[model samples]
Target chain A: MTRDDLDVDPDELYGRLKAYEGRTAASGGTGRDPVNEPMIRHWCEAMGDTNPAYPAVAPPTMLQAWTMGGLAGHPGGSARSEAYDELLALLDDVGCTSVVATDCEQEYPRPLRPGDRVTFDAVIESVSPRKTTRLGTGYFVTTRMNVRAGDGELVGTHRFRILKYAPARPKNAPKPEPAPKPGLTADPARRPRPVINRDNAGFWEGVARHQLLIQRCLDCATPRFPWLPGCGACGSLRWEAFEASGTGTVFSYVVMHHPPFPAFDPPYAVALIELAEGVRMVSGITGVPYDKVRIGMPVELEFLRVDEELELPVFRGAEA
Target chain B: MTARTGDELPPLRIPITRTLIVAGALASRDYQDVHHDAEAAREKGSPDIFMNILTTNGLVGRYITDHFGPRARLRKVAIRLGAPNYPGDEMVLTGQITSVAEGTAEVAVIGKNGIGHHVTGTVTVQLPSDAPGTTDASRTDAPGAIDAPRTDAPRTATTPDTPR
Candidate 1:
């Protein structure tokens, strides 16, 4: 109930939280609303997904969306049990009051469609022992929810996990800097590496030689970028390295900003370049402002020496 | 039509904004205080209201289908979350085709935000039969046939088939 309750034994508290494992978090729960087109439209709109397959059958990912109880808190009635409540209350009493959802995994055996009445039952799958994180020390509470249709046919299962933790620093303390994440560094040596394997090793070798190579199916003559072993056009396994003209146009691109990583500058451009050979590759776009890099902008290929150990084939676009 | 083994989809950059975060949560019917209430989120240890898992799932599904085409049916999506997707950050989603059989393909997807990877998972998508690169025998043409219109993202390479 208060920070004064800090005297609670860690082991005892963890044991109590762990006791709720396997208990029903929700049972015989009917969705407050059935799967419908409006929600699907909203979801698609918010996500900027324009796939026409939607509004006919719901997105499989929406399996859990239909079962969510929003701000109104399951207006029909509470399908949640007191065990989950008591669990959270227990954590709150010890000042582990902050809660952040950390993970979710869902499997859809069948597609959910509009007009299907949804029902679900959830159980407290597991509770981890108290662990400290950059966010703070707390237990990870995981729940598995089985969503079904009105006919009782299981549609999907959603596993959701949350970290119920005490803030690592008090609110009154000096503002804490963003936590350092792994694989993020200012050191040039820590730059992200490309995945190299036998199939594409030759492509990297070409980059090392300042020769931009596109894989061509020797059998069909179809050229492919990113160097796949077989041809999608003819299914030919036979291929050869063909030199590119080093000319391309930006097909699409994005500007990176936020959560700065030390190895690179922020607000830079990453582009999908369509080669004159009719193949496309994703690489860094240089010589242009992040915002000025537009679709159809002409660019020329260049091998950028990222570090002593690596050379990447990036494209240079003209500044607008 | 180029959904094939070992093929990589072009990365999609998603700008993280408060509107997108709150809209996504609301759209998913997730009304958790930490997802829409910034003060409440900070109180709960997050610097800001963060994206919800359902939203992340939705985004992942969208990412796959955006490249594979509209008719692509997602059979299964198994993902593990890593870092939080806070507002003011961006998530770049990159996917690689890992396996292909018959008319179905499995892709390994990673969504990395400012701090680190926000989500890592694999998606199994059922490509339309007439779709390009549907393994053996569906190969409709040869060589210059590469310019055939496809259902996938525009201008992306049709890295059709790789050794199964």
Candidate 2:
């Protein structure tokens, strides 16, 4: 809507963004709380993680958690340098207003423990020249934050990226592409294998035997699916395996229609099935149209063995 | 291993499943219903629950580190999303080293899924400076080292709607 007013010079804008690189984006920011239990608990609960090492230690994946400004940033904590704002305004002026995060790379040199005071400073790492994406054309801006503890030990480095782009002209609700005809889009010759290794080999071994197994914690009896070596709930390496009943309720489901992978047909339904044993695992839903798959739908497991090498557990709608 | 500027890093195939999609989102503390709820996503104009950009970003980082090994650390990774990776789609990641100087290598990377390219960007990594007994042959034969380090030109996409 706003591009009509300006005769934009693409190179000048690119030059402006490049100039903002390596500037101080923010500094002297402190986490509102010490790396503590409440936030850790919230993260684990939402993640369905039962790893035993949490609370005492944060998940390495939470490297950027402490630096988040949240929905309403704190009064003084929203202090970004003027150059950062000007660069964003320059992008905004050129109609690259819609922003979406692209990627992040975090390196943790030390594990953050509870009560470790979190303080961080960030620098405008780098800004890219004009790049186009399916979402729209935009510039990629990156920021690198070095997080340290109150004790002054380096905790981690978080490099975050975002693409500020103009929204693409809406395709105006195009018709869902029809599944390819058999001769047009032939099925893949073979199903791909899961990344199987020492850590989760036992789970696949159980699948090979046609037994749906849940890893049960020896200390807490908590049943977890997609097996883990140690229990997250109580932090115990001691665990036993139990056979699942293969009956489940569709906790939630989606009908996939795009970016058609060779191994799958479009418009197929995938469901998060809550097993009768009280754990959830994801699998394809069968015996019904993708649209008809509903939340709370009862389904039973059916292991579809594709070709000689691959066998996967899918769910079929169960009779009333 | 000595790398030329155009030397293609081996591609990494990642299966896009409901679980992988959801797990990657949750791991990043992204609780947007659009990521986990299909009905919610449909209301917001998506055909299905799509993988979030954060997950796509994390995967891009994983691909870079996996190729260069532990000695190399990512100094920066910039990416843009293209096609939405839905359940049952597989993403194939490919990259080529564009420049190398002073133990720093710039790589151009893209991840293509069943439909089209899911992401494209550049990753700059700090390779181990102490590469023992480095020779002129070990220096990448590709263009764009620090001396002539210019930003990558915009890439043209094969698909009309694919991200470049």
Off by over 4 Å in 2: A1-7, A45-50, A75-77, A170-320, B1-49, B53-83, B86-164
Q: Considering only chain B, report the TM-score of each candidate against the true chain B.
A: 0.83, 0.79
Clashing pairs in 2: A50-A232, A50-A233, A51-A232, A52-A232, A52-A235, B5-B142
Top model by lDDT, which number? Answer: 1
Residue-wise lDDT of candidate 1 within A62-132, one digit each (tens)? 88788878778687677787899899889888878878777777778888888899899999999998877
Question: What is the DockQ (computed on Cα atoms) for candidate 2?
Answer: 0.06
**lDDT per residue, candidate 1, B41-110, as tens digits?**
7655567778888788889998887777777789888877767888766788888899988888999898
- Candidate 2, A1-320: lDDT as tens digits: 11222237878878888999999987877875678787777656444344455668775556666765654564575656677888889988887766666666666677788888888888999998787654567888999888999777888887878878765543344534432222235555465779998768888888899988789999998888788888978989898888889999999988775444556756588899999999999899888878688899999988988778889888998634
* Interface RMSD, candidates in the order listed: 7.2, 8.8
For model 2 the local lDDT of residue A239 reads 88
Clashing pairs in 1: A1-A93, A98-B44, A186-A262, A232-B160, B1-B132
